[model samples]
Target: MEKQNISVGLDIGTTKIVAMIGRKNEYGKVEILGVGKSKSLGVHRGVVNNITQTIQSIQQAVQEAEVTASEKIEDVTVGIAGQHIRSLQHSDYITRANSELVIDEDDIDQLINQVHKLVMLPGEEIIHVLPQEFKVDGQAEIKEPIGMYGGRLEANFHVVVGQVSSIRNIGRCVKSSGLELEGITLEPLASANAVLSQEEKEAGVALIDIGGGTTDLAVFKDGIIRHTAVIPFGGNVITEDIKEGCSIIEKQAELLKIKFGSAWPGENKDNEIVSIPGLRGRDPKEITLKNLSKIIHARVVEIIEQVYVEIKNYGHEEQKKKLIGGIVLTGGGSQLKHLKQLVEYITGMDTRIGYPNEHLAGDSDDDIASPLYATAVGLVMDGLKRQDRKAREAQEELQLEEESYDDTESVEEEQVLESEPKERKSFLDKLTERVKDFLDNAE
Candidate 1:
């Protein structure tokens, strides 16, 4: 199989590092060949703070995936998220020299490239430039401007930005692990792709990915991403609360949160309690479930409120910004008991747990379908889409080359009949120069 046909997704998250190997199956669904996970020791809130530990974790995950899939891994599409990630809206346009010429993909590409050149704050760089809408000569809200005649083309872009050092740290870890970076995608967007359906995007929806150290939000309307934000708190904070409130170790706190915590405090009975083995040799300490739920409920409410504030900032009061499809929660933290219910109650919108099974083959492992793997699975999907696009572009280039060759033959006959050798050489030289320039600018 071609190298492009196989893709790997590396999710260097706060709680764990996941390496997933996947390829498009015959049915056009992702066939997950193998998945490997390792405890992430160096990453905090999605940023690599310790290069050595992060590289070791990545290697371990990739080695396990290789063993399971029986395929060596090299290139991987990675996911990025943290408090440092931010997004904003900007409008840009370009004037065409020939107004009579219909706008094409090249025009759109040029417009996007212009937006990429916008000056950012010091130490910041644009991660994604998503075109929200387009306008041609003041005609607004054009979903696609291709094949339309226009003198001035404008577009509103949702640009995601991040800290340069944070991104470089991730790159360093990937390089030190002996892996090539295929691509880097925002974690929220990746999770959204893995869990959201076309209908949901069309109807408007909000995706909340509650990972170990950060909660990511991605809002979509009219099939376009409108907003993205990263909250600094997540499941790890709740675990910290548990540790402080219950006076327990980090491992025990995490275990308690996962096994017995609930977002709704009222659901837990006062009489229900669990005992934790005391450290060293002391008597076991009993903790009431209701109290534990109360602690979790407090933290969960804060996170939900922060996320809802972002949702409101998207102009939710306006009819166009209303999310009829409501909120879909994913990631490891979304598994907290009654989280969906809590989100619905607080935000007053429909809510559901999002599993990353939408694009997976039916025969895929159950573990791969969990919300925790959403970002990794979506990264693989992005890789496959990119590969398909490259293949299509290559095919079109080949066809264009054949057509140009045929045209050249006819032109050569005309030149021979006219005996214009100088004109032919000049034309051929110009064409060769143009081809070189085009190839140089292709990427």
Candidate 2:
């Protein structure tokens, strides 16, 4: 009997922990299997400060998912992002030592491993070694170089690294919850995989995943990743501004941001006022709508400007790509009112909010399929790809093992026959042959 494949994505964010389970159908489309989420505790600024509380939160989320899906989960692909994330670019070249002159998969893998060995910060470890393009001798931007004659093989790559301690802590917490860690994918990479189009990547573009506590950005040019960065502040900061400005509690601030926040202040009606109930026995207060928008706009603008600075630091490399598709803003924070216009005004580039519905089938739950699930949904797609790769490798290994076993069995039989002595044909010989046949059948 054959077993069906199931993939689950567990996202640990600053404000919450989400677990999404999905499976691929016969037609190669992802179907929602289950979902679970819980408000995170003992987590501050996207880093886990207390492991025990984090583990409890994770268990709660996973249990809810299991109940909803009527299935038990043991492993998941996790998403991670924070200010501790960083990206660096480097190139490696190798000339074949012998006269084979043709490059193969091994050569490419060796060169990439060499790039991964590059020195990084003391506490950081490389997460991904993304190949940009392969160059043979002087020719550049080759997507595939296998079977091509090339004495010199070179590859341009983007090396993404993160704080080792931070990643290890997350792994420990997941392990404590009795879940196996598949891999840790950077949040921006997961979001980009969920929303960005191949045409946009080739034409050059920037993807911003704005979550509760951090805004992640990834730049793509010539169909390869050029830069990735994590800004430490995000939508939670806007909520905090509302709390401080209105003298309201944190819960009230979050509710206000969701219910009435705007990315641009000028878009709000000047005369509009939101009535707030009095605290305890105090008199009720009426807060101006424009004022709330003002506070939200100020914080969002700062985040967008930081993205612009990252683009600028990349220098003429930005000019070459031209970013015809401009920016694709995703994640939970991208849903703010007038955010597209705000980003365009600040970066001087076109902007649009990214939704992960492109790969989904007809009439799914609109709430779960929105930009907020970019990382979660992308993790499901990633699980599918990884499953296929592993299946293929397993099939090849099984075939090799079977062949070796057959050869060894045949050698043993030959040795036994060569060492045996021949006997005259008789009733005993016939009986022995029949007994051997019966034993073979029974076995």
Candidate 3:
């Protein structure tokens, strides 16, 4: 029996590292095989700060996933994000020597490669070169330029850049954990793939992934990504605020926020309070739910406002750039109570929590389908897609080779006929003669 293709997604996040293993079922939905998570101690704000701890966390998560799935894991598609990640738009063009030649994939690849050669600030490297739109010989907005006759080809690209040192640290961790880095994808892009629908993207939408250390925003219009931004603040900052505001331990603060925190202070009553047990026989401390909400609300608002400013910068007020699909929020931070309402109110845009269940099998674990796993799920989806593409390309190459061999065989047969002029036996005649000779020899 042949083994099914499986893909692993490793999300090295700020507060936690997650490893997910999955494969597409016959019905075209992701069937999760296993999931593993561990508290992150080495990463902060999406960048790996402590290599040793990050490697340990990765190994732990990968081991758990391997145990649950009953398979050996070797490679992973990792998600990368941080304050060091930034994107810029640039227009570039290539002049062709032959004016009458039709544009081909090679031509497009050359153009993209040219963009990769562009110089950047020291220590910064381009991570993604996403082509927005193409122009052929001064003709504008050509989505597919192949087979079009043009002397000059041009395109606008959204290039994502990140610090080299930060990227290398992640690679080192993955290598030290004994796993190959199959690919690296932007976290927000992965989240969007897991949650956003085609119709939403085509109609213009914004995907906000509020992870532990970063709030990533991706804006899409007319099915093309228009903008991407990573805000340094995330759920961790909110927890920090709660810890300071309430004078509680970090662990206790995290528990309190998950259990009682709300982004909308108005939703909580002033009289509602939760008591935290004191350490070492000290008196228990009281925390009002209303006050907790206020603390959360302040940080959440700041994060939202920073993200909203990016949306505005995208010229959302302009009719062409308006995001009709509004905003879809994902990631663990999005699980907070009343966050959707708060975002809607603040941005004046329709909002909803993004769950990864859209592409999951019906029987997938409920926990894996939550918004928190969107990035991991999306990474697996991306890996599967890449596997399929490679399979298709391999098949095409095989077919081409077979066709070439057949042509060569036909030419050989013709040459033989021309040289000897002997009548060749039909396939059936040859087989019958061989069988008769064998029988006669046996008798």
Candidate 4:
């Protein structure tokens, strides 16, 4: 099969590594072909800690996905997020030599390239430089600048930055696993793509992707990304709190959290108790469900408040920047019971759990449509989109060549009008043409 028709999304998270293979169906929906997941052992807080272990995990996931889909995996689009990720706002302008010339895509590309040259903290590099609004000449707040006449072009940028070393580590791992790295996308943005619709982005919205070791925040307004942040706390922290508070093992705590954990402590009754078997032959321990919820509630609230602070920093409190679409939560941590209610109560905004099914085919598996696979789904979409863009670009190049050829053909036609272009013109033919043209003009 042609490689262009297939796309693979590799999600390397702190809790698990997922490999998803898919293709775009005729209806523009993504048809998931196969998915493979494995426990992540060498990653912490979304960053690679052990190269060998991470590579092995990636290979295992990819191999499983390959077997299921009956296709070889050669390249993949990957998601990246960690505490080291950060974003900032910046403004820049470029002066054009001629105001009479209308602004074009090239001009915008030039301005973006200029912003890319901005100095970063020693080890930090820019990941994405998204333009917010544009100003042509002195006119401001223009969303589309093309075809507008302007001497000076200026715009505000939302620049995402991350540690270069951490980025390199991920690249090395993918390469060492014998796979080509197709692209690296921010996890929050990927999750947003899978869950948030175009209408939501246009009306403004905030996406919170709660992974195993980190929580990612992405805010969109006026159909443009305005702000982004990464918090170090995630599901793992909540599990740690549960284990410590209940004096139980980590595995049991995780199972309990999945089975009975609630973000709202009020939902649990005081008499409800969960018994945990002790180590070796020791007596089992009894813990009240209410107490268990309290631990989760505290950690969940802290994480939500931190994300809220980021929203506030983006000026969401202002009428113009208010997120009418509110918040969409996804990723592995979003599955907690009553978590949506807790978020809505704390932030006072409408909240919904984001499922990756938004762009998937109607018959996609229920398990694959869950919020846990949102990042992987989005990455696959990204890969397919890139493929379309490349094909379109190639077509444009082909058309340009055809147009140029037509221009030359038109020249030959004009020459034919003066004489016979089908026949080679010798010295005698040129002299006869000159004599005939001179005789005709003289008459």
Give all candidate RMSDs, comma-separated: 7.4, 13.1, 12.9, 13.9
- Worst 10 contiguous positions by lDDT, candidate 3: 421-430
TM-score of each: 0.90, 0.87, 0.90, 0.91
lDDT-better candidate, 1 vs 2:
1
Write model 4 residue lDDT over 112-202, tens digit each, in one string.
8798899999988777788899998789989988889989999999988888678667777877788877766787888899999999999
Ranking by lDDT: 4, 1, 3, 2
**Rank order by TM-score, top first?**
4, 3, 1, 2
The digit string of per-residue lDDT tens for model 1 on 1-443 reads 66678999999999999999999989999999989999999989988898999999999999999999998898888888999999898999999989998887668778877987999999987777888899999999899887899999999998888886787678768877998776667889889999999999999999999999999999999999899999999999999999999999999999999999999998988899999999999989899999999999999999999999999988887986799999999999999999999998999999999999989999988988999999999999987876776676577556555556576877556544433211111211232233334434543
**C-alpha lDDT (0 to 100) for residue 18 of candidate 4:** 97
For model 3, residues 1-443, the per-residue Cα lDDT tens digits are 12348999999999899999999999999999999999999999999989999999999999999999997889788888899988889899999989777887678778888998889999987777778899998999898787799999999998888886787677778877888776667788889999999999999999999999999999998888888999999999999999999999999999999999999999888899899999889999999999999999999999999999999988899997899999999999999999999999998999999999999999999999999999999999987876776676566556555656677877566544443422222222232233334434544
User: Model 1 residue 229 lDDT?
Assistant: 98
- Candidate 3 scores a C-alpha RMSD against the true structure in Å of 12.9
Query: How much is 178 displaced in model 4, in angstroms?
Result: 1.0
Answer with 1 or 4, whichever has the higher lDDT.
4
Distance from true location, Cα of 61 in model 2, Å: 1.0
Give me the candidate number with maximum lDDT.
4
How much lDDT does candidate 1 score? Answer: 0.87
What is the lDDT for 59 in model 3? 93
Candidate 4, residue 167: the lDDT equals 69
| Residue 316, candidate 2: C-alpha displacement in angstroms | 7.4
